[model samples]
Target chain A: MTTGTASARTRLDPARRRTQLLDLGVGLLATRTLDELTIDLLAERAGISRGLLYHYFGGKHAFHEAVVRRAVEDLVAQTAPPAGGEPLERLLASMTSYVDYVTANYEGYASIVRAAQGGHEALRRLHEQARNVLTDRIFTEDAQGAVIPDTPATRLAVRGWSAMTEELVLTWAADPGPVTRDQLLAAVTGSLPALVDLLR
Target chain B: MTTGTASARTRLDPARRRTQLLDLGVGLLATRTLDELTIDLLAERAGISRGLLYHYFGGKHAFHEAVVRRAVEDLVAQTAPPAGGEPLERLLASMTSYVDYVTANYEGYASIVRAAQGGHEALRRLHEQARNVLTDRIFTEDAQGAVIPDTPATRLAVRGWSAMTEELVLTWAADPGPVTRDQLLAAVTGSLPALVDLLR
Candidate 1:
């Protein structure tokens, strides 16, 4: 049985094994902060030796970077706007998706976002890249940027609004207070256009 | 000559020496990140041997906690709203002070906020306490909470506004682009009340 189990784990190629380990790590993030996800715990969860996990990730630091990058990629992909909709509808759809995404992945997402705030350079860069994709979606929604006006002040508003939206959503997801998801969504959805209107 | 130098270095009592070391660390934060403020570097700048510095601080981790605490206190003090003013004027005054404080202490301020996000527990608590103070000031500006009714929705908006303001100020301080400080201040100052108004 031991031989069979070892072979079952080793059946996958190196690339496949790395992917599997990362996926498990990401899954764990739903319940655990990265700091708390020690190598021993991960290895035990995966039913693999600690040495094997290290072999795949080299070390905790490298493993964490990989996990965060993967999480960011998932976040960016999930938050991507729809293929067809009016500007307002598209924006609402995007916002709703964001609220839902973070709602479902609050622990993982918050930790990643919060960690990026820390001095983690690699994570910060990854986070900034994800943020750019999110912010850039606003401009791309209207090719000429006419609706939003891609000037510095508008850009600043959008960036600021992004921060507001993220903060609100995270707070809402965590405790939600008296606010329902719909109410939360409406407020978040309304605020972006309201902020941009002020710039105009 | 050696004895004179040694005595001069030790001139301050231990408590005073500790404060001076912490103050020096905080000052360094204006230009360098806490991560970059190593004991070796601090000791060199303070003209104290690394051993003496270690004796005072115990370790780097404890030293960082003390520095972050002091920085947060300074930030809170600088951002306290005026004792008397119209709610709107007081809010604006507080916002402007916040912008100016961050402008002067951008590196230190950013690092601390960022580190708080990074899952540094003590730093995160300090950051949260600072955030609470900033948000709570919104309510205290009017004794009745008349201008800004302190509801869950309003509280959420205030918290969100704080995030937006922090992000905008930090970004503006780092790279104003075409946005002037006054313009940035106006946008930030205007946004908070506008956000609260929406909740109404």
Candidate 2:
């Protein structure tokens, strides 16, 4: 029986094992901050040895970067705007989706925010990528149309608007009662026209 | 002569010693992140014994909190609006001071910004205090006068605006001249009236 169990574990493909580990990481992030994550604890939880975990991630920092990157990718996927709508309608849809994603995945949102502020190089790159994608969607093209010409000022405005949206969503997620989701969505999207005007 | 040197070091008052240690920390922050700071390095830089440094700060975390608090206080003082001006003028003056402070003290600004994102409890509190003071000045009363009523929405707007301002200043500090300081200042303050309008 012991030999059979060992053989089954060893037979797990590397890709499958990696995915399993990453899924465990995502689950753990729901309850723990990235800073609090440890390889030993994860290994124990997975019923594997620390050596096996390190074989997959090399170290805690590497594992953390992977987790952060995955989270950011997930966020981008979750918030992607649907096809074929008016620009304003698309913008509003995107904003609502963003708030919904944040509220539903508070831990992932928190992790991304925390990592964006002077985290490791990979994590920071992932953060910038996420921001750029959102900015591109909002400024370069939207469902309604290409609303703004891509200029330096437009880029700055988009980035600023992105930052504002993030801060508002984070605040709302932490305490939902103070402001309803609709109010939060309205506040964020309503401010965009003014932001575009300022950029112009 | 050795005894004399030792005696002179020991003769430094506790208040003076604490100040000396904190000043070293401030200097180190110019080149290192707060998490990178160490008592051993500080003691060596200050030509004090490790025990003496520990005497002033029980641990590295405590020392970091003290340094962050001091930096935040210094930032508040540096950015305080000059007394008795129109609200718009006062707001602009305050914004200019903020930009100047951030440009001159990039490291400190970075540290404060980083700390505001999931740092120690004390550092986070100090950051909120700094933000509150700035937000209050902007929303409650200035030379121009109280432009917005103090409501939940108003508070949210002020906070969102503050975060936007911080992100802009930090970006400008990293690479100046793409947007002139005046442009950055104008961008931030110009967006505020609109934000207030949106909130209303």
TM-score of chain A of each: 0.90, 0.86
Indicate the residue-level lDDT of B107 in model 2: 73
Instruction: Give the 10-residue window scoring lowest on summed lDDT in candidate 2 chain B.
Output: B139-148
Docking class of 2: acceptable
Off by over 4 Å in 1: A1-25, A36-56, B1-21, B40-52
Across residues B1-200, which tens digit of lDDT does each residue of candidate 1 receive? Answer: 32676686657578988998899999988888778988998999998799998899889888899988888888888888889877778877877888888888888788878888776888888889989987887887776875788888889988998899888888888887757777777777777767777665
Query: Model 1: number of clashes?
Result: 3
Identify the candidate with maximal DockQ: 1
Give me the displacement of residue B101 in model 1, in angstroms: 1.3
- The reply for model 2, stretches above 4 Å from the true place, is A1-17, A20-61, A115-122, A139-145, B1-61, B115-122, B139-145
Question: Which CAPRI quality tier does the interface of model 1 achieve?
Answer: medium
Q: Chain B TM-score per candidate, please.
A: 0.91, 0.86
- The positional error of residue B188 in candidate 1, measured at the CA in angstroms, is 1.2
True contacts kept of 2: 0.37
Instruction: State which candidate has the highest TM-score.
Output: 1
On lDDT, the candidate that comes out on top is: 1
Model 2: chain A TM-score against the true structure: 0.86
